[model samples]
Target: MVKFGVLVLLSAIAIGQGETTIESQCQVCQEENNVYCESESTFLRMRGAMKLGPLSCEADEVCSNSGNLCKKKTEITNEVLNVCGANCQSCSADRKYTCVSRNQAALCLNGQASSTIIIDCGEDEVCVDDDDGKAFLCVPSCVADYQKLSVPCSSAAFTTPTPAPPTTPSGDNQKSICQAAAVNKKTLYFFTYADSSCRTYVYCERSSSTSTDFTTTLSGSCSSPNPYFNTVSGKCQASVPDNCESEAPST
Candidate 1:
């Protein structure tokens, strides 16, 4: 047979606080001002019953302290599971499309869900986080190349009936000069027009060991009117021509 005990506090304060009574089979000590002496023991037993061990014990008199502790524990457990989950792998999508993890899927293009394809790239591969928290496909290299088209007119050409400049290089054309000098040899570079002409200047540096690997390859033209390099994404961007920009230039 098990023993039972009913402990009752007859104080008016206890009655008003609804803490006047406690029923249990174990030894329990009571305190004034609505405090319970054996509260830790009761809480430990409750946690044990739930298979959580004594980790649920509170460190302060208020329940908020215990709640915070439990919440922190839950967060740690979740982080471990997410990073080390059995299905841990890279994800991919189509051209002009991107994908990220479910937790970060909102950051994807137009806040859409990531595609189901899992890329085989390693963790070191470059990637972007969509607004939804999903990691999207990104390029790994920093260097890129693009072809430009242009038709130049000479200053000496027809004032009233001047003929158009030759379609080919004339040994004095700026484009031919740059092409002969190989000024655009560098892989990662940015180009922009000057004086509203077809002359495009490039910005770049020699590759080094610490170069940054760009992740996303944007197809649209940059909206800004200047050509500048983005250090964070390692890409060169132009302000004109909508949607033809490459991924960030490599550092």
Candidate 2:
């Protein structure tokens, strides 16, 4: 039986005429933290392809843009090497790759053919829709269910006086940087959006109408120390932070 990667590569080459002719072998590509499939011929056609860097795939996986993963004809190249551990399945399926065996960390997957990139949300974080909704992203458990997160700190996290709970205070008391409810008192410390500098952690609480009080803060422009918000954990983190939380919604 013909391997999936081999088949995709052959197909691309067979059609190359005016094109630079993709080699008759699978090729790898990279972007951000992702690995994908791209023909050498196609890469050369790109305007700024050189900025993308070298192409590669796992030793066991073949780079096939059509297959979406390192698998061919329904067979996976590297099963045990799945991202997010054995609890998950393929990480190169499509826009959102990954199979969950447990409620543990969800992986943000993206790639073409067999080469893919998997970003870990860790056990505490859950994968959700990115801003673009084109792909999945890891977000804090708190952010996922903000209506149920209880922030009971008696500090200045609340400035805008508004109505109390919708009906009754939710049964959420988990500790996280993303607060769902308004703190009773007013303080000066709050979870800010993750920024490139990771320097600010203070955001003025946005107040809602008197009937329902919800404190919403904008992204970026937070205080220092844990300025950048880790998107996955919905928590404030230090500079050079990972996990996708940030003032830049692009993350």
Q: Which has the greatest lDDT? A: 2
Residue 140 C-alpha lDDT in model 2? 52
Question: Which stretches of model 2 miss by more than 4 angstroms?
Answer: 1-8, 12-171, 174-235, 239-251
lDDT of 2 by residue, 140-250 (tens): 556444523211111111111111112211112111223532244343323333333443222323343231232433222222454444433334456645633424333
User: Candidate 2: worst 10 consecutive residues by lDDT?
Assistant: 1-10
What is the TM-score (0 to 1) of candidate 1?
A: 0.16
Model 2: residue 138 alpha-carbon error in angstroms: 27
Task: Residues 93-184, candidate 1: write the lDDT tens digits.
Answer: 42232222221111223323233323332322222222222333332212100111100111111111111112322223333333332343
Cand. 1 Cα-lDDT: 0.22
Q: Count the backbone clashes (under 3 Å) in each candidate.
A: 29, 28
